[model samples]
Target: EEATLLLRYGQWRLRGASPDPDELQILFELAAMGGNAQACLELGLLCAKIDRQGERIFMEHGLANFKKALHWLERAGEAGVAQGWHALARIYSRSIYSQRNLQVAQHYLEKAAQAGLVEAQCELAQVCWRHRRDDPLNDVKALYWWQQAAAQGEPTAQAALDAFAAQPDAQGWALQAQALLTDKLRNSSPFLSARIELAATFGLTKPEALLIDIKAADYGHCLVVDICAHHARSKRRLIAVQTEAQRATLNRVSRLFGDVDCGFDGLEGNYRQRQYRLRTTFPDLG
Candidate 1:
């Protein structure tokens, strides 16, 4: 009860025209040390603000403030405050923090989302979508979290879902490529054959199939065929992965290219070499 009163008094001071920062901090610290979870969270946020301000004054002071913020926020999170994890995630996501770490931020965001924080769900969905190139399953995770946030009446999440639903379905361009894959070609150039199969499955053009960085292009829900660096005439595009066959084929092809460098300096050689190899393998192809 004493901690709760102190917290209330600190909040009342904040409502004043100009409160004393030192006094407020002392009150918050007293409340937090008295085991008030909300006070801990508030103190953590206050310390984080101080840390940011300290950045312009003293590097050591900034680092110390950040450590204090992290400690109190962790305490709040352990006390089951969902927003504490969200706050920690926001801190870790910013480069201003000396301890900035995207992977750690993602972990805390996930924790907040699982704890039923709607804002965390929305933010996590955006993070997954934005960084899909780093993890192929991120798109799938994005969809899941967006769905969760939308169900909670988040307008932005609903808008994203609507946009996803409006995207064009994958076309049927694989049949022609499939007909060209002879057994001899499959045995002799297994890598090229796999690329052809992936192209057929995902509707990739000849150049995209030959020159795309396979590992970097697979975004689970879509294939980002960007080979513009190697093929100057080729444009970057996304092929939606709408079918089970496309997913399976992508998985297989990605595994094949996992250990192989698909860049110009790698064993695959430059765009011209790959194109020449493709033309040599399938002389009748357009």
Candidate 2:
């Protein structure tokens, strides 16, 4: 009951015409010490603010304030407040904080989203999309978070979902390629097999897969298949690496072709020779 009275007085002070920050801080701290989760959250938020003084005040006292904020927010999060985790994520992501850490921010953001915070879900989706080039699995993760937010009636997430749906689907091409390339035939020619698997994974055509340079084509987030130099009729195209399986296949194929020179006079020979080898290895491909 003492804790409740302290919290009430703190809230009352906040609602006053001109509240005393020192009094409110003391009241919230007393309540928070009495095991009040809401007090902890409120105290954390209060500590995180820099007031109107800006960088000068921050330089003098902001570090200690940030540390206190993290401590109280972590306590609130441990007490099952999803917004506490989200608040921590914000502080960790901002440059003003001396303890800024993107990796830690991502971890907390993910925790808040998983705990059913809609704002966290939306923000996490955007973060995943922005860093998709670092890890192709981020595309899949972004889609998942957007879907989660959209299900909760978030308009921006709904719009993003619609946009994702409008992009070209590559499942059909993947299925067709899967039907033609069997494990036995793929194993017959290790080099050709790797190319075929990679093509099927990213919806690449025969010419693009066989002639394109694996190392040169990989642009982290997407594959830039440009075989126009070897096959005049083929135009350069980009296929996004959206799935974990696609990333795995791409990594495997990249390692396979790492040492081998993929040129006209290389061990693999020209495009025609590679094509001939494929047909000879798999008689049914005719």
Candidate 3:
């Protein structure tokens, strides 16, 4: 813990002034060995980078350094650091590395996304959209993550959402999702608003379903909007209430965002207090 603290202090110093690389290296090594995930990640990155100062670190160690970097990265990931998974994904995706594997890369990216890394979510969405693997394309998933990142104020994700909105086949669901993510709603409850926005995006973007209507919930103190969606393939109608409460929210959101999607906020008043009327009546989820 001392070593990790020192390393963080050294890093903070590095932002303003030049710190001795030898000293920093020793601190990183100490902290990394002590199970500091951030230190391990930093050390891994240092090992992976080309040492231009004739230190001959990579040259002397050869692939040993790269392998060590992967070791530390895995350790960091095992410790539940999202950045570790993201870094590993990037390293595995790079063509210059002999260890390049898109499948492994995608796996780590998904792990990072599961850990709530916005960049990983955005990248995974792109991967889904591009159908980079032999696996079936999932535009719904692509839009889902895109909405996730966009709701978190990621500019790239916002641009992607805009692009999707421009596509005729996208059905303007992105626009609807964006509309629901207003600052007013965010101010009322950032956490709940984000979840509602996510649900809105998921409901509208489902490839198998067509959004039919959105109306006020029949009962609830929480701001709940009943979403009526019809499955295009099965011609089945389903209704999901978009609310901040954990009660009756997961099944629908997870259908698009994945089983790991569980970031729920219990704040609900924006919808209930500020009335927004609609002209749609649909069957409730039965």
Candidate 4:
């Protein structure tokens, strides 16, 4: 209960990353014993997402992790841990666990929703929306869960709500989400230099980003773009451009996507009249 409280109220922020190994061992042992499935699930995510002993060992060993994680989650689900059901739902939904059992996927996610996990609610809603809607999907239940998630102070939920609400203008909602995500992706990021490094590695002297699509869907703002580069001396530049509507969705894109090795070059330009180079790592040199 105390551990759950720590996680729920954000006290874990004070716990920091450098936890005592022995203490952490004891903590995990106790939590697993106590049927705190969230602890097991989170431990799995950490082990998978974080490096251990200079080796990235998570998904490579995910079969084992998921087994143990499911064990704890099933127990916690029976014991009425809301997040436990949520974990079980995620595992079942992911092919690693149940091997892509959509029926079970729906089952566990619905169970989690009944247990009041807003994240689960949003996910299940998307599933419902997908079955009923076409490209640029939407469903009433999906929108409801997004609203619920948004109201719970989940930034993702909020962004999603702004995307697909019943308003006449989904682009407007995307703009609202943009205002929320300004600080995370732009201005200060360690990966900021990584973008540049990629261009260097790919033999691209200059890369450009062209905004192809930015629109709100059933969940949140969706952004699609064509990025190009030129090693040619004459047209060596990167450009990114979007309509005002697209600019609003850009924030949504920044929040969800990390430094994907999509071969992105850089922000060549913004808004209309933006200048962008065309493709080719060796343009004029060739």
lDDT of each: 0.78, 0.77, 0.55, 0.45
What is the overall TM-score of model 3 with all chains considered together? 0.52
TM-score of 4: 0.40
> How large an RMSD does model 2 have?
8.2
Would you give me the overall lDDT of model 3?
Answer: 0.55
Q: Which stretches of candidate 3 lie over 4 Å from their true place?
A: 13-22, 50-64, 132-137, 162-286
Question: Candidates' TM-scores?
Answer: 0.54, 0.55, 0.52, 0.40
Candidate 4 lDDT (Cα, 0 to 1): 0.45
Instruction: Compare candidates 1 and 2 on TM-score and give the better one.
Output: 2
Best by TM-score: 2
lDDT string for model 1 (67-118, tens) is 8888998998889988889888888887888889988998999998988888
Model 3 lDDT, residue 114, Cα = 82
Whichever of 1 and 2 has more lDDT, that candidate is 1
Better of 1 and 3 by TM-score: 1
Poorest 10 consecutive residues by lDDT, candidate 1: 50-59
lDDT of 4 at 35: 51
Per-residue error for 2 in candidate 2, Å, reads 4.4
lDDT of 3 by residue, 1-286 (tens): 6867966965665345554555655777888887787887777766665321212233443343568777877888888888878878887887777979988988998998888889799989888978824542355567667777877899998787764441223435433544546677556544334444444443434322222222222122122222323233443222222234433444333343342222112122233321121111111211
Query: Which pairs clash in model 1?
Result: none
The residue pairs in collision within model 2 are none
